[model samples]
Target: MADRAGSGTPISFRGIEKRFGGVSALSPVTLDIEPGEFLTLLGPSGSGKTTLLNIVAGLVEPSAGQLWFGEQEVTDLPARERGVGMVFQNYALMPHLSVFENIAFPLRVRKISRADIAVRVKEVLQLVGMLSLADRRPRQLSGGQQQRVSIARCLVYKPSIVLMDEPLGALDKKLRMQLQLEIKRLHEQLGFTALYVTHDQDEAMSMSDRICLMDGGRTVQISEPTELYFRPQSSFAAGFLGEANLFEATLVQQNGHAFLEGAGGLRLGPAPEGARPGSRRTALLRPENVRVLATDESAENEAIGQVSEVAFFGGDTRLTVTLPSGMSLVIRGSTGHGLVKSGRGETLRIGWCDSAVTALPEQSA
Candidate 1:
């Protein structure tokens, strides 16, 4: 087994930028990936996540930037000389080659001794739990199995870093979840530094140690999963990560507390600290944080609305409530017996704690 902690140099990106003709594909961005850490680049399509990955993998050269692997400047290094492993979304295995040959191809290209290649191939196949299917060709394997072979092939050469570009996108949901866990476990065991690119929020949250969120070729935020979910620094981060009820408001007053006034004469409690009074801001509250309460009970922040729709998911019930001001909010509740019974046209009182709301700079509709 490879030494986990003392393995290799960390990856560093400085002043990275990529442009195609008149349009910029990636803006000036800089980041560092610690050794043995799993960092995910998460964003929607055309957000430059893949472009950044390609740049790091030597598939695409950055228009401007310095790339470093530990103390060595690798900005000018070719893909083969950089010693980076890459797993693609599609299983790019050779159709005629057996699973064993596919995993051994990298070693073969390097002209490694035949005996050494066989031993390394066996070790990686065992590591990925695909040893038994070594005789099978790519066409004979399932999608998940083919992905495993791809991963094993990448790891066979023991590259210091691994880049995965949406490798699980081709699998079904159930298989994807299973492979996600497997990949995470393998990373923990092998301790290889990894940079993964994906647009799926759940995949990024479930697997990444830190996520770099990008939009419009710019990095919006880089944070842990919990921080990104609970204390988003921007409205786009909040909305993109999960369901949020966003309301446009103006900070009206602040003394011991802050106050916001929204459309249709609605007043909500104080904004969280750092939010200035009289500034135009947007309030973000997650669906799970909002709750339906009885009419007589008071809450820190309450609103009157009518239940516009109800959906009963197996684990939780979702209710869409339209406020008197015509704004809609979503509330989540456990789907157990005695759960709040709400239906369309039913009047409902919605409330949330002051801490549950995050204020962001308002954006144009």
Candidate 2:
């Protein structure tokens, strides 16, 4: 079973570009996807994530450059010849077919033996945890179950690479989260190369080995989830990936210490490395790094703000704090924190360590 599950394949995209007449949908992108790796194309609408995915799927041909599947240059290969299985957002299951039949369709299309088809179908059905519903039609199953069947169908043939385009987008929040983990588990078990596309940043962060963050029809940054979230190279990457406090601040050296000074005399902890004093820089501070200071406690960067909003989310709470400068910063913390219990109109001093503040390049902003 382990040997049969090793269908992972490496992929390469070199100078791939797409244009619709005079409009460019995807810029020249050069990326390599490792075997058995889960790489997600993440961005908002019209960001060319879909275009790049389609290019790899062979559904959209690149206007220039080449694509390689392992050592094979598949730039001109047809979609059917690419050894790629696609799972789509709409759960493209046959309405009239039962789960078993739907999953067996791909095998049957390739003219596999009846015995082989049954074995493959059974394996994928068990893998997706829907063996009990093999006889159920698409309409009889829940949206998540239908999607599982769709995924099972894609896996039944053991395609070298699997492409999922927002496959969990249609489900509710709880179900979406559930499927995300399920997909990750399956990827770990089956060890299939996966190229996923989604506009959901949380989904990308939670599932991918690395996230390819895209914008303006180009790849902005490709890095691990933690790096992309915490140490983004661009303001767009920082602001787009998560809740961030972005400020235009100036580096100041005083009394042998370096700090950042923002508008309205706002002061923060030490500036990032290589920052020259008297130079203005864009700094990003994440919400989770900010904590409410106690009476006797202090932080390198502290600010007093009025709680403008509060939202409770079971184990944690989020607060929107408006500083004296009219700038707002969001803070998230465990419910046990004193600041998490604070309500609107309450004032509190929130602080973060110097390392929490990251300076961005001027051109990146």
Candidate 3:
């Protein structure tokens, strides 16, 4: 299991904050990334994702807080001395150097002998499946192949921690997905500690052991992929990690269960335990969890809506259903399994069980 704690000391951030000019890029943040675990920093642009990663990599100095790598405090350490590997969005391979030389550069800089460098570079090239391209220059390789060389270079140094900043952002969708699986496999094989930064929700969810979700310069949530998807702690986290239908509601009663009332007489059942009653809240429901029921099927929560729009993706069909209350919800169903034809003004019943809904304390929308 990804959550299985290791015996080694974990990375800890204590009240980490960074400021630029008058703007605070990252507010007070604290977290512990387990040793030998794959952790991803996920957020929108300017949300301080890269800033936080840079801080971990010693590329940027934090205005406040301390950073620790295992039991050592590295808040003041320089980049070169941090023993961290970094793969950037741009494959930073030297144009004049072949793949073998590129992977050997770090060892050479550290004063390793030519014989040792060759052995290390060969091992990493084979690890990344780029052994055959060892003599090729950056210009001689495809985007994916170049990335492999870059990754090989990073790993050749055997850094304790690897930090990747949008390393796949420049690749096309198909190639990106391919590399995503490759990286996941590599992580499982090596068990090196990694802190990945990306804006793509699917990419993060697919590869990371846990996702650290950030927004507006603050850490919003830290959870395993499935937990983050199914039980987000905040409305921002719920909406950002994946698609969700969020609605403002008021908690009406509390016993073993609670009820929520939304606009246009939309009444919903109790949220999961831990939600207090008599408070305004936000409900997040995933599209896949919202079912399109047959006319006679009884549902825990039901809404009458008309199909306002439909989109056919290869594997799934996305439907935009406008409820009678004038709220529109996006629902996803298997392409071959959903209703064959749905158009504007077509009536449908949409519902979800009590398990699908989550309530969060009301925050600024």
Candidate 4:
């Protein structure tokens, strides 16, 4: 692949805010997207993920604060003048144009010579593994094929930054996974700064170098996927990233180790930092990190619960255990882990390592 002239550029949002009538679509947010990094904006609907992406694309201007592309200020720049590439969910390819023409559109619009446009378009098609489909129109290709063309078009211009708004939203699961690998490869190969937006936690976790988790138009947490999943700082962050077994408890400290104590002698700990000793807290236990213990075994973090339900999902089994306090616990383990030994209505002891519990701040009322 040919190297782009200005391949990678950093983007910065300095205290950006957006509002419409009496509603605040986005609160003040300050973030920096590093050069050549794939940063994902992840959150649920109405969480302002799309709004932040649009602000970077120059589609929606911030009501307050400045936007910067590298050292240059682009707060007032128009969408076309910002020199950014955009890939959308619907694969916004021209239905009447063939693959080659669709990829060549941007170069032609810039009035590049006929021969140069042809060369650039062919190169991008080959980069995306779609050169063989050059003659096919959008209507003639499958959903995946059209998306490949859409990506090829975005790459043909070789813009320094690419804004993707759920580009894989329309594809089936198999195709989505396949394209995810391709996109990761292309980003690594070409080194374009990318800001991708999606509501799918799995997609964000798999593709992002760092995830910027958002909620209700505010930034919840921004960190690598592992940290976000294992060390969430808030209740919303704990629940949004993946399946977490959350328990309400009061924070307490004995000697040096912190603990969370709930009703029925349920205690879990080595709580995370910044937790006040007497404050209320929520203990986050990841299903995969939880262990189903034997009757005679014991640990610092243990609970007695009756089996409620069991689900087998190919390589793993999901067990639902109801505690004496009527709390439902979700535990994920390998199918061969002997979880079924204690059938439904049977009592079992479940435990986790003290280090596995992530104590987070309780939700505010």
Candidate 5:
């Protein structure tokens, strides 16, 4: 196994920007990736996550600013000279080559001796648990097996940094999940700096030490998965990371607490800090944070709404309740015996604490 702490170099992106003709594909963004850390670029389609990854891979050059890998300035370096390994969605295995030959391709390109190549190929194949299938062609292996070979090829070279672009996108859900755990384990063992790109939120949250979220050609937020889900810094971050109930309101300072006053008898008490009275703001309420309340019970935050939709997702029941104010909110609760009994069109009382509400600045164009 490689030295986990000393294998990779930290990367720095200083004001990187990319543009095609008159439109900007990626806005000026700066970020730092720690050595030997797994960082994921997560976003929807056309969100510029892939573009940023390409910049780091030397496949695309930034129109402005500089890029650094450790102490080397790589802004002018070509992809082949960057000494980075790449894994693609399609596996990119040569169909004619056996697994052993495919994993040895990179070493062969570097003119390594046949004896050294044999040892390296055997080492990586065992690392990915594919040594037994070394002689199988790409056409003979299952999707998961082919992917493992692809990863093995990337790892065989022992590159300090590896880039994965939707490496498991073609596999079924079960296989994808299984490979996700496998990839995480291998990354922990190898400790190569990783830059992973994916549109799947679960995959990003599960694999990344930190996640960088992008939107509309700009970076929205970069933080740990838990922080992005719990304390999203922007309205887009709150809505995009997970399920959120958004309410537009104006801040009003009460005797000792802040409150959010909305239209049509809609109100949420004890607003989050930094809200100035009379300023328009947005509130992000997560579904799991809101709970169904008994008719006589009072709570810190309460609302009366009619259930519009209800869904059972095995582990929990989801309720979409429409308030008298014509706005809707989703609440999720445990699906245990007799819990979440409210049906469609039934009046439901929902309550939550002030801390459940996160106040964010109104989104801008």
Candidate 6:
């Protein structure tokens, strides 16, 4: 059944814009979703991710721009005519219909033969590991199961693009993580282009082939998970993906080498390319880069502080160290093996490599 689904078709958005009369819901966004790629639209609420998704799904019309699905232009096409499947936050299933009938609804709508509908429904049910419960109704299934049935309903028709608007948002943490992998597996096995919308960075990081981060009703940054986390080019990109110690630093030059002087005289160098000397630069240092140093050990950037907060999370520990300049820095690591043995009120030495410090898109005062 998965093999018969065929490889995905790529879609491109050319200057897509949406406006609700006077208010702009989406700026001119031109993005390409690659074939068979799992791309996530990640941002806070009102970032236009949902609006953009609706445009792709033909639910909302863009005020401007063209939408291209492969070689065809679907901007003016009807929602029903566009080959798009949707899975929503709340499971939208027919409570009166069994799982088999729910999934078969789409195929039946296309006037497929009863024999074909049964075969397709059974095949998709087995693919999603719900074959045994084909007779279960929506009310009888758990949230996760109902969501799976929703997905099955979408897959029965073999739509070119799968649009999922926070399909796992209703589930618990453990179940959400489980279904994230499950969805990724299905995408790979079935080879369908996926356009997922979510505000959860962790979920997007774990599942997306590339994350399209949006903000202020515009596209912020689009990059792979690790790249987006480690070397984000924008301040919002750096802070939104994870915890970041961001500093508005003044650029300093020594021996023709560039350095960024941050709060509490914190110096980070050699600055990344495009950094202008004597200008205010934004610097980013993630908690994972910070090391709990011993008295005898030193790193490129060293700071001594009093432990202000200590949190134990299984094998890992998070510590907040308040430095002499009153700037608090957070460190995350596995301290159970002696990376850090200090507690609140105790003085601790923390440092990180010079190379670990990164510069984001420079911002003015």
The Cα error of candidate 2 at residue 324, in Å, is 1.8
Give all candidates' CA lDDT scores. 0.87, 0.90, 0.86, 0.87, 0.88, 0.88
What TM-score fits each model?
A: 0.92, 0.96, 0.93, 0.93, 0.93, 0.95
Residue-pair clashes, model 4: 0
**196: Cα error in model 4, Å:** 0.5
Cα deviation at 289, candidate 3, in Å, is 1.0
For candidate 1, give the lDDT of residue 251: 80
Question: How far is 289's C-alpha from truth in model 6 (Å)?
Answer: 1.0
Which pairs of residues clash in candidate 3, taking residues 3 or more apart in a chain or in different chains?
none
User: After superposition on all CA atoms, how large is the RMSD of candidate 4?
Assistant: 3.1
Model 6 lDDT per residue over 1-365, tens place: 12234478888999999999899999999999888888999999999999999999999999999999999999999999997899999988988999999999989889999999999999999988999999888888999999989998998889878999999999999899999998988998888899999999999999988999999789998899989999798888998998988777888888877888877777755576776778887888899889888768989888888999988877888889898778888889886656457679988878899888888876522
Give stretches of model 4 more than 4 Å off: 1-6, 253-258, 272-277, 295-297, 340-342, 362-365
Taking all chains together, the TM-score of candidate 5 against the true structure is 0.93
Residue-level lDDT tens digits of model 1 in 41-74: 9999999999999999998999999999999998
Q: Which candidate do you rate higher for TM-score, 1 or 6? A: 6
Cα distance off (Å), candidate 3, residue 343 = 2.1
Global Cα RMSD, each model: 2.9, 2.4, 2.3, 3.1, 2.7, 2.7
- Clashing residue pairs, candidate 1? 258-270
Candidate 2, which ten residues in sequence have the lowest lDDT sum?
1-10
Number of the top-ranking candidate, with lDDT as the measure: 2
Candidate 5: Cα lDDT at 156: 92
Give the residue spans of candidate 1 off by over 4 A: 1-8, 254-256, 264-269, 295-298, 337-341, 361-365
| Candidate 5 lDDT score relative to the true structure | 0.88
Q: Count the backbone clashes (under 3 Å) in each candidate.
A: 1, 0, 0, 0, 0, 0
Task: In model 4, state the lDDT of residue 252.
Answer: 80
